[model samples]
Target: LLGTVLLGARRFRGGRNPQPRRAPPSPTYRERGDTTESFPLDFTAVEENMDNFMKQVKNLAQSLYPCSAQKLDYDMKLHFLENSSVTCNDGTPAGYYMKESLGSRRWLIFLEGGWYCFNKENCDSRYETMRRLMSSSKWPQTKTGTGILSPLPEENPHWWNAHMVFIPYCSSDVWSGASAKTDQSGYAFMGSLIIQEVVKDLLTKGLDKAKVLLLAGSSAGGTGVLLNVDPVADLLERRGHTTVQVRGLADSGWFLDNKQYRSTDCHDTVSCAPTDAIRRGIKYWGGVVPERCRLAHLGEEWNCFFGYRVFPSIKSPVFVVQWLFDEAQLTVDNIHLTGQPVQEGQWRYIQNLGIELRNTLKDVPAMFAPACLSHEIITRNYWIDVQVKGTSLPRALYCWDRSFYDNSRNNKAPPKGCPVHLIDSCPWPHCNPTCPTIRDQFTGQEMNVIQFLMHMGFDVQKMAQQQGMDPSKLLGMLSSGS
Candidate 1:
């Protein structure tokens, strides 16, 4: 059955978009604090006009260049967890998709990203929107495989031919929780068990024979990859796959140790600090901290949940892909210091985050930290185009992967320090201009309103009037480089 699936999948040829031969000029932004803050005369009229203008721009752009990636079809089949006992958050069976193709005896397992839930209210809210993800019945038979999961060798040269496993996020534990707790609210946490069962089943299906393995995840899933990569590799090695060259890649999972953000309320009205969420998750899920991390931190086991603290103890070679000014940190995480006109302190905090991140991964094999405002990168077009010092992110990653897989001990190590591909400028200059005008695949609306406002020369006062919002509130949102 596996051979037949691979043979059939080989017929589907995926094409890659040509890389931009020449780099575009670095984007320019107006000097901050240059313009005066003044409200528009008519708030309602300005709002309507701006909305209509944005709509027209989005429509025109969509007509000219629809997202070509979304149009392609790939032979990806969703398979429910074979063990009847393994289940997801609503007691539904857990599931994953496998796209088998002819290539090396390698495997690329991608853990899907969705933030975790701590309590029943959080779980219930997540369930409402993620029903399709939580249940196998609603799994899409065919998915457009793009980004790291792209089936085309031209696009994803690393593991295009290797078996691809797409594990859906349903357990809400970052795949690290073990003990199941049933409260009066009937919430169950079984992420760690689900991962164990999934790995066992994959080994039976040929993962045991894998010569190369890349365990990767984005957002919360990225956290999962970091926490579980060493254990997963150990599991495979114990199963007689010791020769497998195992590596891990975390996309946008470089969560910081900014506990201060927890005090501030997030856009969702929840605690903004990820540490707070981690603490709750640990309590409810009965998750175990990595032994090395626990030993290092002694009594502060919770510190292990932060990527900065965890990276030092990670034994395997891992690559971290993140943005210096991550959108999630600014918006969803609510790390702002002042309400309006972005105080100097807030900017300092963002810069400190970058410095801390660089210091944390100083010894890692590779890192791609672009100075951009966006969150995720591996799954977007930016993965190919975003450049630093004349080297595109994909090219840098390719070079690093080559060095990582090199078996020639005689060859000198690529470099002792982390091969960081980072952008020098602040995120405002690197923000993708097309983001504001482009229509979102899910929302079918302009994806970035702040970018649009900035591009169109709209000031904070005008923006506040147009949206019927306070100027201070708008300024705080703008401070994040939204």
Candidate 2:
């Protein structure tokens, strides 16, 4: 009982449990001095007691991935690590099943969101976002017909030449600061795998490192870019490993300093997503551990980044994008009542979360563009938006000209109407994921969810173009969400 309570306490404290705050400097056991078991297994075992629950998730990853109908590769590479303080590994974990596609020109890599192992049955929200991206990208088909600001339309997507790599979120490493059931083990291990193996494979296949980029959705991607970039950049510097460009889009990103934005606390004691939406968040898309891991449930790790904050390093210029009223961030915490109007408290909760996250990261010059988008629209994060309605306006946020990026573009007009506020926008507030709004309700002509994401993505692409960077890289990670 004490063990369960302690483990539950950890789970309640950390977003993924098992990696509790207290420690004897031990990796995951309840007792800081206890080093009686393997690192990952001990930390993770309690939360993940292999009892029918995990087998189901493992079965799911295997079953869903093997639909030869999809013409996919199933087996994954594994690596083991052992050390007193093992922060870096040669890539790969001891027991992981990875997904990769061979003979494709475009590489689609999705970063894991939570510290929990990727095997969670509830993490399916990621799929909802990815499916939208792949289907909308219309790549693997023809790009010429994509309709808007499509730059690479004439270029071949080279689907045959492309190979995709899945960043696993679990590990079976040794002597590391992790337990099998702990959350850190999953995210850290998965990120290490992506950095070590996926990137390594791309270089090995003669793919230009500079051209390869990684994308993430509804997830943190563990910010491996923080660690991997410097070392990999060093490798690129020495010509040892080719440079692999990584772009991170943390959808409804939860990594910002959690104290301010970790959902409002009802009792001044505990924080939560929102009482009204927490339930709906679970039943809508099958969110498991919703209560235990959801924001409404509001555990510690769900919002803490002590590890990353403590080990701060600027790896790649990872673009951390978000939508204004994100359901995934707020709504995901609880299940919402079906027919009721969104309550005042719920509204405040959602609005505060977005503003807090946005303000926290605004001045880093890391590249930020917010639209009047909602939760996680596929097109919103991927497409580019502009003041496209009330009046004719030339693109200022992103122009082919280099001066535009240096903030030299004159504030052309008093800024034309955005068109979003004018129309019954299908996506706004919390409707689209990667939205940014200076005014609370500067309404204008509105676009559909897909339209919004495309608008946002196009802007990102334009930024890359002005900066002289490749756009197709990591199309999966950052191009979608809410």
User: Which candidate comes out best when scored by lDDT?
Assistant: 1
Give the alpha carbon lDDT tens digit for every residue of 32-108 in model 2. 43332212121112222222322333233334333321342233333223322222221223221223333223344
- Lowest summed lDDT across 10 adjacent residues in model 2 is found at 142-151
Off by over 4 Å in 1: 1-73, 181-185, 259-262, 265-270, 335-352, 407-409, 413-482
Q: Assess candidate 1 and give its lDDT.
A: 0.63
Q: Kindly list the per-residue Cα lDDT of model 1 for residues 336-431, writing each as its tens digit.
A: 423233444555565566666566656655777765556777766446666665566655665666564443445555644324454444334234
TM-score of each: 0.70, 0.40
